[model samples]
Target: MNTFLNTLNSNNMQTKKPFKNLKIFASGFLMLTGLVATAQQTTGDVVKKADVDPGTTITDGAVRVIDNKGTIKYLQTQNGITMLSNTTANVTTTTWQLGGVLTDSTFIDIDGKLFGLNGLELIDAATESASTDATTESDAGTGTGYTILVRDEATGATKKLLATELIQSGQEAFTATLAQTTFALTGAPVLPSFSQVWVYRNGAKLIANVDYTVAASTVTLVENDYAVYAGDIVEIQYVK
Candidate 1:
């Protein structure tokens, strides 16, 4: 009976030892689980105005990602969230005054000036500056009495004068002296060269190098056409 009693007690002790060890292991597992929960941080249903501290940080090359199910909602590297649908609205403090696609008809507003896709200003206003005095081609006119814009080579400003005020079709009329052969072309734009000089005698066009020859700014008629009377009309046509 004593020996049987000792064996029974020994078995009980062995069984209890395993239970104690299991209890210690369960306690250690529970403590480790609590530590793991503490290490993870979560943003609950409430909106946070101030910055919330995450208990643990990610290592190098690892970034925190916000996702719904498997789809990514936001990435840490990008400026804004990855939009999944149009139903959600994201508000940010960032803003810009100028932005538009080149293919779109909308203009990009820079300050108050709006520019088109071609980089042309859409706004119409007065002159860019008082000194500019610029005029578009629309401001020009043709025919008699109409004024045309001309740039003054001296001052480099655009000025306007009647079309009639310009040289008459590049033609200058002169009264020839009695039997004058050599005539000085003082009104010619520059010294006339060779065939560029076209001479007319009394409404008749004279052949160049046949009836007359030009040298420097002077035109000398051939001996046959040299009989220019005092009252004869001589006309010189040239290109400027």
Candidate 2:
């Protein structure tokens, strides 16, 4: 009976030992958790909070932000920062300003029109032709109230004309026949204004209304000392 009691006590002691080890393991786990929480709190205190102004100069790759009435505005870069939204920042003499010169690659889009540096036309040929067709319906004669945009060849200046003041028929050149008195224009262009013809006899420009008279499609030379003989070269240029 004594041996049985001793064995039963030894079994009970072994069970109690396992319970003590479980308590020690739980205490060690709690200590490890406390250390991690303390480390996280220390890290939070060391981290810097974003402020309104952090000085003007900043290193590259460092992010800077500003809070305006609970709205955040981020500005960070070595050069310029592209704003995705509309900016109300004013250009100041002491602050950032636009460059004086624009390169050829720079372009600006206003409404649906695309313009390049120094008022250059940046549209393709097809788009420009379509726009011109829509504006001027194949004809730009006088009294049509349509304006023609003309550019100065020498000065590079552009101007608009209400009437067809600059429209001119292309130069037409041909050899005169035997005793050719009347010459007909092959293009059959209409002349809105009279006395605007420029006739050239043998490559020399002649005075209008003095050398020849243009009536409708015919150009008849005045019965003067100079007459157009056979094989004589005749050139005519006039505003339609």
Candidate 3:
């Protein structure tokens, strides 16, 4: 009976010893796993907060950003910063002033041909005059009206009439007489007191009856006819 009791106690001791060893091994493994988890967390935090070193070389496709004042700068290279592609930046204010009229000397460098208001019309510089007649029982009289000539400033160039010349009697004004078309001024034997006749080309009125006369195909006017005359002033404008 005593031998059996000693054998049973030894068996109990062996079982208890293995159980203690298993508990200690389990505790050690748990501590090792916890230490590995803590190390990973510390490394991640350091990486997140650390600045990129200047000596570090980044390959293509790597991206980094910098905050400068209110602008966000993108790192294009190790030492260079640039605005990001397709990003809009703020601009400053600007002012503008009105410029005066352009002159002929202004340089125009546009493609194709250039034209201006003067290019549309031909101008003449010759002066011309026409006659007006009024006849009464006691008086058979003729008065004259003059025209100022404006010609193309360019040499050998001809100008076309901008507007036709007309005759006015009382409240009636004659229709425009076109160039190369003949029309006669036929009226009562008596001429109206305010028989104001005039001519125009391009909105400019010609000088009254003192300077112009019509020949077969051309109109001629002398410079002296521009002087104001004692008789009536008539306006005649012509262009060819």
List the RMSD of every prediction in angstroms: 27.0, 26.2, 35.7
lDDT of 1: 0.48
Alpha-carbon lDDT, every model: 0.48, 0.49, 0.32
| Native-to-model Cα distance after best TM-score fit, residue 240 in candidate 1, in Å | 4.0
- TM for every model, in the order presented, reads 0.31, 0.34, 0.14
lDDT of 3 by residue, 1-240 (tens): 233225336556564553464356445544533422422323332222222222232222222332223343222211111112211221111111123232212222234757344554333335533423322222223333322234456643333331233433322223333332222233432332212333433344555444444443223334453333233233342222
* Model 1, C-alpha of 34: deviation from truth (Å): 60
Q: Which regions of candidate 1 are displaced past 4 Å?
A: 1-169
Worst 10 residues of 1 by lDDT: 77-86
- Error (Å) of candidate 2 at residue 231 is 0.5
Candidate 3 to truth, TM: 0.14
- Number of backbone-clashing residue pairs for each candidate, in the order shown: 0, 0, 24
Best-performing candidate as measured by TM-score: 2
Residue 216's lDDT within candidate 2 is: 81
Estimate, for each residue in 54-151, the C-alpha lDDT of model 2 and write its tens digit. 22322222222223243433322212221121123311101222322221222222447674458654645543332222243244442323355676
